[model samples]
Target: MCIPPEAQWKRATIPDRRSVPFFGQGRGLTDSQSLDSIPPPPSPKLRRAQKVAEQKAQRIQDFKQRCGPGFSSSSAWQARPWQHRIAIEQGIRKQDALPEEMEVVEDPTIEEPVGINPVQVEVGEFEEPTVDVEEIVAENPCQNYHCKHGKVCELDENNTPMCVCQDPSSCPASTAVFEKVCGTDNKTYDTSCHFFATKCTLEGTKKGHKLHLDYIGPCKFIPECLDTELSEFPLRMRDWLKNVLVTLYERDEDNNLLTEKQKLRVKKIHENEKRLEAGDHTVELLTRDFEKNYNMYIFPVHWQFGQLDQHPVDGYLSHTELAPLRAPLIPMEHCTTRFFETCDLDNDKYIALEEWGNCFGIKEKDIDKDLVI
Candidate 1:
């Protein structure tokens, strides 16, 4: 049968389904209808890239799962309506279609709760923080230290604090020569401060340790002590000490220098007219007066020792500790050195209370430590 002209023309113009451009237009069509059929097998490089992409996606999913609801990779996509529409179009349908316009309108019917309960998190009790011992030691390492008067604290290589004699130059300057003192070495210092500072600088040396402040004034010719004078020295010194205390008691109306306990003790001696006043008495008069007022002499010697033994209070006199009493006496009294040297009966460097009392001619029974006021 011959086909009609209109039907023939229509059939000729219609393209074959296989020949028409489809999703995989460049690739030849086959009977298969799956995504694998649409595209050919990728190159080795592309396959490797695809594998890497799949692994990255899997890692992201695992990270989200581990983090729970606290983490989300698609938060930005979810926040944007345009992104959400694009994602939906790409994932659900690949056709060009206009997205439905969405208007966000607040719903008045959805009311907030009138009174919501606040989240009450149960907290554990707080504990005091513990400090490290090293940290405590490191903090103000120089604190709680003891150094000599003219010395300072310093840290060593191991970060340990130590005492070192201060530089003499660091000491404050003397305003006048009135403050000057002379050393036994015949050296005159600008001030007592300068003398002590120089002495500190010479610490641990033989000459320095032996050196001492000789007098209040500059150095002068001090006569050598004779044997007779040395024997009489203690008598004069005892008398001097008693007189000094009496003088202090008489003048201590303000209660500034002597304590009330000390004043009470000295008051008895002050009232005693039999007590010899401080004067240049003959040796016979001194000896007679001391024999009569033996009790008066005991307290002064003990008091002097107590004053000198203060730095460590070990009941012994160190050379430096004896400076205040010994220094001034050394220049004025020629027998001072011989007297003190004889006092150390045991030949020990320090002078014990017993030795000191014995040297002053106090009887053994009367040489009481209790008298050290």
Candidate 2:
């Protein structure tokens, strides 16, 4: 039979206890237990303290890594990237000192000892007592173009004025494209088939080869003279002038045969004329309808004055040849030449007019003595 509940409770009521191992406590133990022996369940304060300690330790490790093996001395610890760099740099400067390379220059004012041989004294002498006209002048020691000592006025290959070779390695004309050849050929066929056609034309017959090679270099401009600036007008201005000026010369039916490039020529003359009127001193031009032999300040730009019936001169031909000099002229569409012929006449050189007057219709008489073409 079980004892009654009240008697059982009374028997077990004696007050005795042993220690709790995790809490490190015997009966009524003090709170200063070894932390390693009995760790408390982590609290917010304990966790925060642990994190702070970890970060501090990490920072110390990083500092040690930066300092390397030589950082054993406490006084040499550098806490910043820049400060550490400076310390290393100082060490390097000390290690790499170049005392043997030192050059000692004497003060010119100091006089040599009286007993010293005159030859040795003269050999070392640099300062002259006074600049005498009779005394031989020292020859210039600078090399050509390498020394900034040359007079700055010098002409480049293109005759453009430039700085002399003070900085020999840096030439102002170095980046300039002294020569450039810009050109495009008519496709005639679609892009893909054109290549095959070009090949067939080139290889099948010498005549075809001569034809295809003609379209090279920039389209020649018709100006009365040697001014490259006026000959190559800005494209937009040329286009605007072409639209308006060619209208002055071409009839719709006649213009149908002229190339787009020919149309641009007519446009440039017109545009430049307006610029000239605006005091730009552009060259005045006369387009003669070689067919009618009608000389006028401006051509009937709409009417196509095509190629001459006979070669004006038997030599190399070019796009400029498409221009007519006499009446009953055929347009370029009608008067054709071989391809290679276009590249002839000093192929690399351009057709330069002797003077501006020969390029435009205006002769020396028409020009005022004070005016420039």
User: How many clashing residue pairs are found in candidate 1?
Assistant: 0
Clashes of each: 0, 25
What is the model-wide C-alpha lDDT for candidate 2? 0.33
Local lDDT at 229 for model 2: 37
CA lDDT of each candidate? 0.69, 0.33
Question: How well is each residue in 113-189 modelled by candidate 1, as lDDT tens digits?
Answer: 44573544334444667876763444667787887766788999999999887777776777876577888788988
Cα misplacement distance, residue 190 of candidate 1 (Å):
2.7
In candidate 2, what are the lDDT values of residues 78-177, reduced to their tens digit? 2233443333344334334424345688858966655865543664467767755886876433324331222244656775555432332232222222
Q: Point out where model 2 deviates above 4 Å.
A: 1-349, 353-373
**Model 1 lDDT on a 0 to 1 scale:** 0.69
What TM value does model 2 have? 0.16
